[model samples]
Target chain A: MTALDTARPGISPTAAASEVEAQGRGGGGGPSRRKVGRVLTWLALTALAVLFIYPFVWLLSASFKPRGEVFDNRLLPKTFTFENYIAVWQEAPMALWLFNTLLVTVLATVAVTISSSMVAWGFAYFRFRGRKYLFGVVLATMMLPQAVTMIPVFLIWESVGMTGTLTPLWAGNLFGSAFYIFLLRQFFLGLPRELFDAAKIDGASNWQIFTRIALPLCKPALVVTAIFEFQAAWTDLMRPLIYLRDSDTFTVPRGLKSLVDQFGFGGEWHWEILITASVISTIPMIILFFVGQRYFVQGIATTGTKG
Target chain B: MAVAADTSVTDSPPGRPPRRSSARSRETRAALLFISPWLIGFAVFTAYPVIYTGYLSLTDYDVINDPSFVGMENFRALLEDPKVALALQNTFIFAVLSVPTQLIVSFFLAVLLNRAGRASGFFRTAFFLPKMTPPVAIGILLLLLFNGQNGLINEALGWFGIDGPDWTTDPVWVKPGLVMMSLWTIGASVVILLAALRNVPQELYDAARVDGAGWWRQTTHVTIPMISGALFFILIVDTIAAFQSFTEAYTAFFGSGNTTYSNDAALFYAIYLFQQAFEFLHMGYASAMAWILFAIVLVVTLIQVRVTKRFVYYEGEQR
Candidate 1:
């Protein structure tokens, strides 16, 4: 099921070609024409793929190159060195920022996954009063942009004396994210209701049924949610900028922003260090994407098609 | 709500009324208990902030002092605010140009990927790499790539006997630069549309072909209608994302010492709002701008929903 198969989709290219083959055998335009067409298509796709992947290659190479060679318009570095990476580490608080980000992303991902799943189970299992209305509330929250609530949310956190701390950043996720809740709710709704009924008949509490049955059945969805929350927390720049006050508290994104400010100014071009810091910040996410690309694509596919 | 309850009661055969009632009440209690976290979150984070923003829009609240009731003064000022008008214009241009362009490009790429045969997995992974890159990192990369003299973009254009615009320095290319950036991460929409295309049944295509429809005709008549729901989904999501575009414009144009006069062209709606609230400390004015943005988004969404009703084909709706 998870093999990333094109088998189920309508008419795979090879399948269509075979159908052409089966029909009239040598009567139709021969297989050579189709072979040429396939070759051209692959060539075009390869070029497009290179267009998409070139930036990362450029970023990685530029990060290792000397300052003068930064904008040399070359794919490979002539004289790559570790000096920029070393400079980035020694000159900036990269380790501290990474630690801060790891702490926030892990905690917030766990919090959002737990809270969203519980709420999703509620909306999925129950036929309560105002259930649809509450789901509408969830949908509305998704539409309400952070820009709309920026000032007042900031004020609320500030009034509570938590502005300069990381509390305001991850604390919001503990409440439940609308997107995660909606995603999990869709997954939960697809689950068989008979399982819940069976658990209930066996004298299982709602909590027990949720912990034992719903959660176990929904591991894929949970993984998707965790990946999403972790990515969001890790890549977030605005929230950290707004909430964090000191360099000691800066996340990777905010710290990287400061790096640009500090080194990318006043006729002093530090592109190597800047790019190095960016590459370092991006490595974890790239790793995460490669590891969980299937889940990520599945989540996007599910959310998109279901909508 | 009452209709569902009444329907359930009427639909029941007989002799199970009390049991159903107890079961329903039990479910309701369990539901409330399970969703308590979200309810508290909704009340604190969503519900209160919405109402509070409305209240703040009516007053002049600086961070240091209590707000004074300003009535429509901020709104009145907003009408004459050039920055507000400029930001709105820039945002409108962005959404109008970028959304359709992105949709077309993503759909085209999706079609290519769909036809990619066995190479689909490798191509999918490669294309999706950009979307996975952090915006901060992308900003830095773009800044270099789009640099006027030595950037790779212009260098590539030179090979085609074309003089590329100074993407970072010129005011004329500022919004276009942002638009280009927006298109670079078209993977999300591609994935969505790919899934949509996969969901399109094979019988529809065969039927269309049997009716003498060519590939283009089949795509237009059958495939598009089938996937209109996903198209509309990307439309709304991308529009909202475009309006709130900040990190790229902020990081690429306005970071530290690179803030030139032309950088004003990159002052998007959210970037402007950030300036007002954080840079200038015009809390009340920024609040008013935020409300206007909210109203614009709400109206746009309602309009899209109305338009979708006319054109979008939901599969289960017909039956």
Candidate 2:
């Protein structure tokens, strides 16, 4: 068993043994039968894993193949070349798109993380009137479908003359998303009240206590919130699709959409470049997942169990 | 000790009640100050927009002209629009098929991972990497893999002597193809259900075994009930998400200026709504569509909560 087993209780070794035994041949299986069962389970899992991972592997390999060889269905490219990756930049403004996506993602992630944690701290720490009702409003916002607000929110940005710019994509995040606020509030509530009380008695102002105490204590949650928001901002296509009319302002997903339009069916038929761009766009997220695998698992577990 | 410390900060000399109230008010003020961002955001982004959507639905307003009141006209048009019905039907089909399949598949995947011991982490990561892929990328993958001819999926099917249908070009197979693509991201649900599975009490399974329950019996009786909460949560969430499915289908079928594919089969409700509001600039009609969708989601979610309450076993609830 790994740290995950110990972190979560109830999945002891004997329990696992019993689980395997229960899954054995009708509770009267010999040791050989159980061993066969284990091998079959492993084989089944390996096949499923291959099914899940093969497409990406194909995409990754296809990115390196020559244009006509892109659909040849070989996992290994017969003629490997880096020309696709080199040509992708010349064919499209991928560098600008990457820069735009990075900027927007950073701004949006920081804005949402700080703003949501503050609001969550207020909800979790303070005893204020109408707190329950206000928090209910936050939760209710989570239920309200974005389709309902998509038009008017667009109109709001249009009226402000920011629709054609990148402002509409990241600006709304300054207000703190309801989902992140709710998640952070759970983290804040898990904190002991005495930490803040001790900070209070030491003459720390509310802001100082929030910055110095609550923020530090909830670093894992903060990181989770930031990473979640980063992924949201980076992968978000809808907001950019609506707001960005100019290719210059396009994020990676929007750029990828345009690439699909250009290459897939718009008669360019350059499948290699399109596949390369997809691989390029996917690499950062995969890398982040590997680096932050622990936090990702922890964050997902908390959201599931706590909810 | 923490309670005593907490009270020490709030405790005042008995004669000074006004000071206590003032301190309480100060804390309240600080709290409000801290939460002011959400307050302002709620009013601007959520509250105002929702109320305005309600008003907008009743009028025919293009972007250039002021919204003129046509009360009930937009709603009436929605009823008459054939595309509206088609979109709704398509969305319903997608949701009904996708949600249950995703739930069951993810549950079993979680159960398998739960028993995989040392190999669980690698399998989980492999499964979850797809979920982390951007939806736009997934849309591109859908096009690449599900293409009618020479796609990887069809090539793989040919190995088993089964010819795959033209997924993107054929109207009948479009939504089913999308459902298959949606399963690629079941890793999230699997992770959630795995967490729930790990928390299930071992004794319940032991007791079930003592009663001579086998794998399927113990699963149906003990394992499922223990993780029913997570299952129900994924059901509601995935249902909502399925209704809002746009990015992938849009990118695959409609994102390009080219519309030579089977757009009708892929025209999900949100995609239709998006086209009306953004592409055609029919703000009022789209608003009306939005409200209808809102109502449908609300009703479906309510029905789910009410129906699942009996079956979902909360650990500490009074039986």
Candidate 3:
């Protein structure tokens, strides 16, 4: 198995058997049942994957199709045009939405990653009174639903005169995120304590040790934290809806909601324009996922099993 | 013996290292410095809000007026408010019906992917794309697909000579439609379950097969028990999330002003709370509703943990 394969505990039975079966086929033969099983597995997997992906495929096709042809059963547009994209741009403030979304996403990701890493490092390395209790409190925060805190938080923002701005949308991350802190703390604890002791002998302070040793060694975990934070901020809708009112400050989700309001749901169905806007909104996230699939997978795996 | 004693004394020279209390105090200072952000945030954002919400639940206040203590009037009002009961009923029904289906369907998908061999990564990503899709986009897509006459789902049903129900408009079908849409994002649970499945030992399955266990028997006796911890984790987390369902329902029904199709059928507990706080400016009542949700979730979680104690098998823990 590869090093990454050992990141988790168990091996895939099918993967292990396939290798043996391949060797057996090269030498003399394996059972016909095994070959049939492999074929059947492929067939079943292909069918399900298609079913899962069909909605996105349909969405992509409809984004290009003209309004008159949006309802046709054809998978591909009979007459493809850039008209829908142009219409979405001229009719809506797409650029402002992109700007606001990017601003919050980038700021939130950076702020959350740094603050969470620092807090996680403290929990990972320091020995202090009530540390265990403090960490338990952090874990407990994960179960606290946003609905529970929505009103008071809104009031807090309003009291500070930040309610109508995007500042409230992302300013919360400057404090820290519980899940990211937990994930990063697991990564920190895995580091050899000897490194920190050696740094201390070299007259490095705790801050220096964290900046010089812990942060550098835990690059993968840090990247995972940044990616998760960015994706969350990008996809978040409810917070923006609560905080933002003006269209100019609207994030992609709120902007997309407005598009739906203006076109899709108002008596006349403008599926072409609505679908185009949806496609535009999704493109960035899809690209990000494809580019960072490894980190994304690692983050999900660690979040599930790690304490 | 004299030399060894001298070396031991020299190991920690007098006046070289700081005092125990001094060193500990310094470390405490540093640790607090490192975690100061979280400490402040936990107090201001999380801790204060929860406690203040509890207090707000016992009072009557609007944004314009100072909150006055009302002594559980809002909670008592909940008994008389038909909308509050409907919202609670809708939330309960959504959680009860959706949680089990979510667990089964996601577990089945995870099982399929686990046996998928080298193509597992691709399939995992494909299935997960829907989960990654923004809730707003998914909401819009739901509206488009579930449109009564010209939606894609209805057209597909037409190909088979079946007329699909009007999912958005009909109150009877609304909850089911929301559940269906929610099911599209089961990738998170699938990923978690897949990881859990990977942690199960291969030897157990082999030993079961040797004991004449069929696929179904092996799955039931070996697979399920091994991953029970992860199963429980996702079940609790998903149920809590299901109770707070908002964005999807809001986008489909409330976002667009189509009163003909979208109605109170889509008025979930969280949505109603949003209405009370923002639309009607009933902050105190909304805070009361929020506390009730919190208590229900906490109690439900406790009950599940207690009930699952008999069934959930950890690897090394004793019965």
Best by DockQ: 2
Local error of candidate 2 at A147, Å? 0.9
Model 3 over residues A124-227: C-alpha lDDT tens digits?
89999999999999999998878788888998999989988999988899999999999999999999999999999988877789999999999999999988
User: Which parts of model 3 have CA positions greater than 4 angstroms off?
Assistant: A1-30, B1-18, B316-319
lDDT of 2 by residue, A31-71 (tens): 55555656666787899999999999999999999999989
TM per candidate comes to 0.94, 0.94, 0.92
In the range B1-319, model 3's lDDT, one tens digit per residue, is: 2343344445555776535655666677778989999999999999999999888888887888999999989999987899988988998888888999999988888887776666789999988888778888888888778776788888888899999999878888888888988888888788888988888776566566556666677678988988888788888888989889888888878864665464677788999998888878888889999998888889999999999978888777632
Compute DockQ for each candidate against the true complex: 0.50, 0.51, 0.44
Comparing 1 and 2 by lDDT, which wins? 2
Task: Considering chain A alone, report the TM-score of candidate 2 relative to the true chain A.
Answer: 0.92
Q: Chain B of candidate 2 versus the native chain B: what TM-score? A: 0.93
Question: On residues B1-319, what C-alpha lDDT tens digit does candidate 2 reach at each position?
Answer: 2343356556645666655676676778788889999999999998899999999999999989999999999999999999999999999999999999999899878887876767889999988989888999999899889988999999989999999999988999999999999999998899999999888876676666677676778788888888898888898889889899999998888965675655899889999999999889999999999999999999999999999989998788632
Q: Tens digit of lDDT per residue, candidate 1, span B1-319?
A: 3344456566666777755775586678779989999999999888888888888888887789888899999999999989888989888998898999999989888877776767787888887878877788888887888888898989999999999998987888978877887788998889889888877776566566556665567678887898899999999999888888889788776655764446778878999898888777788888888888888988998998898877799888631
Error of 3 at B278 (Å): 1.4
Q: Give the lDDT of residue B243 in candidate 1.
A: 84
Which residue pairs collide, candidate 1? none
